[model samples]
Target: MSDSKKADQKKAIVFLCDGTEEMEFTITVDVLRRAKVDVTVVGVNIAKEFALCSRGVKITPDEKFSESLSSGNYDAVVIPGGNGTASILGDHEGAKKLILEFYESKKIVAFICAGTLVAEKAGIPHKHTVTSYPAFKSELEKVYNYSEDRVVVDENVITSRGPGTTFLFALTIVEKLLNVKTVNSLKNEMLTCSSL
Candidate 1:
């Protein structure tokens, strides 16, 4: 590939990590980075080591939230679900501000399971179609008027149920950001469920 083409192909994906689900965070990062997308794990705290997932997995963050993350630096932001992650996201002022800014900029913002609550709390409209963890249905129904389903893709936002839906959620984002052909190829190579 030409130099300019290579540069244009580069995309930075940030995962806002605060003890997210081990499966959701790792699977999405592993899949996207395997596709050669630049993936960064941003720590919501000041620690330089790693955050322990609910499942006892450890993830080292590339940068801290104290560092500014302008939308220009990344093509998308992903939030993985874990009660700790969701509660931190909901309570952290800076994290909430950044999420809202990213949404307002119309960049790709994705959340899975309880992570959708972070987006919803950021005031992004759920509109006609949306979904979340079945347990969150009561809260979601109270906040956003939308039809619930197994997975919900509204414009640039993608959401799914939980760890069981992690692969589908990642593939959906890949399909949306990359392409259906690429998504299919990845699925075939990995023997993952086809998103048809």
Candidate 2:
């Protein structure tokens, strides 16, 4: 299928691994689904059917690492931050390849908090502004045009800070893959348009 055709579906893949931050992972998936995007939560850990998140919540993967690597139909790859980000970097070549493929295809490659480290390890150069957990500021600067913004959208790469910024991060994803109109409508319906 053509890239445009793939994009029109608004399909997303939320990569998850053991130790992923639950809020960032769930919120991104929730908001994307709310925008009518088809989201697949894929697990980087092939050994586990479900991921045990940072907050102790176990998340089932809709697809395994190998499955997601072969699908290649998603329009975006969303990474949620947490302690497991290092695991994603160190352990999952499938996730890394997926990130590289998404970027090379000009599709969205987004992550939050510590997830930026995984994106960095995946070899997507950050040419424009990006953000991540404040504690990783020094580290993010090495690979990105790092900033302190709650959320940053540069090129096809999207990023946000920690768990507190997950909502805004997801809304930004919605705005990028869908439209401002959709995001506005969602924010209004969710009573967060004015609140934020």
After best superposition, candidate 1 residue 74: deviation in angstroms? 1.4
Point to the candidate with the largest lDDT.
2
Tens digit of per-residue lDDT, candidate 2, span 1-196: 5777656777888888888899999989999999989898877763577888898898898977673364367789898899786566545676787788899998998989998888778888767678889988898797778889899888899989988999899998899888999988998878885544
Steric clash pairs (candidate 2): none
Model 2 regions more than 4 Å off = 1-7, 67-72, 193-195
Clashes of each: 0, 0
Stretches off by above 4 angstroms in model 1 are: 10-12, 16-18, 46-48, 126-128
Q: Rate the local accuracy (lDDT) of all candidates.
A: 0.76, 0.83
